[model samples]
Target: MTRPLRLHYAPDNASLCVRLALEELGLAYDSVLVDRRAKAQKSSAYLAMNPNGLIPVLEIPQGPMFETGAILLWLSDTYGGLMPAPDDPARAHAVQWLFWLANTLHPTARMLFYPDQYCDGDAEGLRRTTRQRLSHQLGLLEQASHADWIDADGASAQGCYLGPLLRWFALYGGATDWFALQRWPRLLAFAERAELQSAARKAASAEGLGPKPFSAPIHCHPPEGSAV
Candidate 1:
């Protein structure tokens, strides 16, 4: 008998990426909602599965896996799709982009979204710095990707990871006015395409994030007299 696949997730969190990947791969997995509002992720039961108390722990037959990038990579390797072939020369490049997203983009976004978690002093200053850094990083990414997706060929796990981050950044990072889609046309186009994917749509709906997650810019300006 096949072992069942399960995912522990929180709505609008990084877990959304994993959900999208599962849906795209046509894998039927059960989803367990983690109550972030109640601090359920920090509970003993959830910490046993992921010591970091993060969202998105995938329970496979072998064991439970944490870390968004690791989960996505494992899923791609095991399922043998949505990624380049193992021996393909482009595989390394693809893997590098995934790591870049995990290490650079994701953490930067966390700082912007939860600045208080990082430091107690100058929260607004921290957000301003993080937003500037993120803008620079996004500029580099825009220059690197001249096509629809990061990988020249087509969409991959990298694109899957990027879609949600971009949407969240635009919506919540307080950079909407300055970091408009018009400035990053290529990245905007890529996000638009990713949003249109069937699996992406399903995953967004499952998370209660709505269908057009990456729709037109919302232009959320920072509060008055804020450092952002």
Candidate 2:
């Protein structure tokens, strides 16, 4: 029998991209909320699943998987959809964007969102510097936005990863004003179009997130029990 898939997640975390990917693939899975306020993610049991103590730990039939990019890649490679063919020339480009999102953009956004975690002194300074770096990165993305999606293809995990980050920039990084969408018209258009995607909408709705997902008020204490 095919064992049920299980996802250990916390609200408003990076795990969201994994959920969006699963929804896009039309895959059924269970969601186990890891209470951040309660430190459930740091518990021994959770750590056993993901020693990194991350919010997203996908338990597949064979074993558990950690890291947002790795899980997304596994799902795409295993499920045979939402990614370019392994041998396709565009596959390299797609993979490059995915890595860039995971490594460069996501980490920089984290510095902006949780400055204190990254630095002990001058948190605001760290945020300002990170925000500036993020702006440069966004400008690069805007310049590269000649395509409808980050990938040459229609929609992939890359778009799923980027849309939320853009929203986060508006909510946490003061980008809504200083780095307004008007400054990056192409990225704004891409985000708007990505938000309308069925999978994106469904995933956000499932997480109790609103249309302006990152703008939504995060619940420190979510409802008790599994959200599946």
Candidate 3:
């Protein structure tokens, strides 16, 4: 029998994106919660698989894979869904925008959620700056009509990634008073629809994300692990 994929995750972490991809692709996988309360991600075994000690390591036959974007892209390419195939003319736009999400938007979120990691002091001030940057980033996305991958009408690789991000904007790290999905009506619509899809429903159920996980955000209450 083929080995099933094993996903090491913490509820509502970056791993949530990967989990969604797996579900959307209808791939059978097993979940092994990484205890954030105990910093299990930094444990020797986890570190050996992912030197960065990040959550959501997907263990496959070849080895353990790290990085959510890389995994999502790989899954889309290998399994043939959630992305425009390599030969498709729109594939170029999709690939480029996917990179932008991975390299730009995702890092900006990291800064907002962990400003102290990038600053000397003044973490709150860093958040203020990051929030402005994040706002601009979202605005850019809101107007990105050329990005076919940003399709809101149906599931795509970018949709899977962006859904969790929109959720965090409303609920995670610190004060989310400055954030509102309404500002990006298109994205808000996407979020509302994405949450009702089969993959997201299963993911939300498994992670205790509650119904309407994206459009209406809430802190996760997992059965086995802490979200923080």
lDDT of 3 by residue, 1-228 (tens): 778999999999999999999999999999999999999999999999999998879998878999888989988998888888999888888887878888999999999998888999999999998999999999999899777545556688888889999999889758999998999988887888899899999999999999889999888877778998
Model 1 C-alpha lDDT per residue in residues 81-100, reported as the tens digit of each score: 76788997778777887889
Top model number, TM-score: 3
What are the runs in model 3 whose C-alpha is more than 4 Å off? none
Q: Which 10 consecutive residues of model 3 have the lowest summed lDDT?
A: 145-154
Candidates in order, TM-scores: namely 0.89, 0.88, 0.97
Tens digits of per-residue lDDT, candidate 2, 1-228, equal 998789888766778888888888889999988877778888999999999887789999889999998888888998967678899777887788888899999999888877888898998888888878988998898887333355333558787788777766776654345557668877766766666678877776777666755323233223443322
Task: Give candidate 1 misplaced runs (Cα > 4 Å).
Answer: 145-148, 151-154, 174-176, 217-228
Ranking by TM-score: 3, 1, 2
**What's the TM for model 2?**
0.88
Better of 1 and 2 by lDDT: 1
lDDT: worst 10-residue window of model 2: 214-223
For model 2, the stretches where C-alpha displacement exceeds 4 angstroms are 145-148, 151-153, 173-176, 214-228
What does candidate 3 score on TM?
0.97
**CA lDDT of each prediction against the hidden true structure:** 0.78, 0.75, 0.89
